[model samples]
Target: MISLRRQPMPSTRVLATRTNRKTRKPMQFRGASIAFTLILPVFLIAASAATQTGEEGSIELVDPKVLRVCADPRDLPFSNEAGEGFENKIAALLAQKLGKTLAYDYYPGATGFVRNTLNAHRCDLIIGMPQGDDIVQGTNPYYRTTYALVSKQGSGLETIDSLEDPRLKAKRIGIVAGTPPATNLAVNGLLGNIKSYPLVVDTRFDSPTSAMMEDLEGDRIDVAILWGPIAGYLAKHAKTPVKVTPLVKETSGPRMIYRIGMGVRHSDQEWKRLLNKLIAENQTEITHILAIYGVPLLDENNALLTQ
Candidate 1:
């Protein structure tokens, strides 16, 4: 009677016991699920908050919905808020991509425009910033140009390549006051030879090239160093065919090749990134815009500099 006999456990009974344990364990599982349900929302909320904070921190302080742009009201081949210039087109394109309307701040071209307008937050972007302007941060250049010596055709000025050419030594060359060309000539020791013009009110005229045109026609100046677009347009449409010879050497002026970029506040890094992306995305459109303003599609190298 003290020795117990081993009996086989019924398979159904073993299964029933396991099933009971599983049924009881469901309650434990339900508690764990309830706990997770209570904690998960808080965890998710914290994660979402961190993500939003990071996103906000990464962008500049400026509102993404409004893009304030700056441009000279009278400068041609560059900007005019009246929507008549290439820079205006570029600005419009940028605004379109950003899904924002442009707010333009116009100012006369003075030495202090950058500080008075851009730094003062009068505008968020300057459309036609010269490359390497330290006053405002610049993006990658979207256009390139050179100073062209424009003169009446068949003037035996078939190929003037440099400002220092002996043939131009005694010639009166018309130059805009306070421009890079004028400064370059002065710095390269050619200022004395150049016939300088003050900031003539007529220079702000729709066709600023008229000053040079009058000078050339009047024989008051043998040649003029004007921006490529102006020179090209003048040459293409002049009563007398003007020969536009690009200068290749620059001892003091901008080298034959210079780039133009958009300007933004140094602190508006997010805007800058957006602009850079837009520029890259719209290269073909930008090229078309520049061509509409008469920028040459190729340089002396004959390479396709634009799309």
Candidate 2:
């Protein structure tokens, strides 16, 4: 959200010269044109200054003084600044290493958070950007996971591997709009038959997953595709005992495997490098962080990163 403004161009004047009747002085006109060219550099400098002024209060990661972080306020299991969520834990760890106070810019996990907050410099780092995404510069993935299709136990939809299975073609699958799992389903032409919801929903009960689980319990949707941690959590606590089936492969769909990583501005190479090093050094601690939230730690290639 760095604001930019264009500077006004320098004014130019035409010089009229009276020669012999119809003959005009080409040299005089050329000289005036050259003068305008000579003033162009000053205009360029002024434009740059204007741009800097517009971005005066914006956050910049190059500053070594503090580390500002952006996170979703309600996306638990991922982030919240109120001493909950895994991303908050990781951000604290990063701040501890950098010897700076952790400042958070909280926003709901919506489509605009990235463009409005993260890119605007409200925060210098985004804790859980999906790896390989081009919208933000992402670090090497620290964790990997597969989308899970959850259903009430013995619901006759158990042991499903692919969304394209004939049994699921007519069934309603609940998917969070704009998530990687939804995209995967769309790529495989499953979106037409799926029921989608915004990733962030108002809490109707204790955990955020309650509403979705209620829908499952009511038979509103035959199946639900959610991130691994969320699916696992619901499966562990649900009264109906939903089965969590990890999706590993599909022929024409989006890749079932995805890696999650931290995001920084592309210009913040130093910060990116430093965070990567920190992740590598604190592998064990990060594993513990994931375990706290029940996220599976996997190598960049989707293999297990820890025993």
The number of the candidate with the highest TM-score is 1
| Over 4 Å off, model 1 | 1-63, 177-193, 199-209, 251-256, 296-307
lDDT of 1: 0.62
**Candidate 2 TM-score, C-alpha based:** 0.67
Number of clashes in every candidate structure? 0, 2
Of the candidates shown, which would achieve the greatest lDDT relative to the real structure?
2
* Candidate 1 per-residue C-alpha lDDT over 29-142 given as tens digits, one digit per residue, 9 for 90 to 100: 458788898999887885567467755313343455677776666555566556787878888888888778777767554445566667776678877665676667888778
Off by over 4 Å in 2: 1-65, 169-172, 177-210, 296-307
Q: Please give, for residues 98-215, the per-residue lDDT of candidate 2 as tens digits.
A: 7888888765444455666677766789877667666678888787776678888878889787776778778888876655566667766777778776533333222324566778
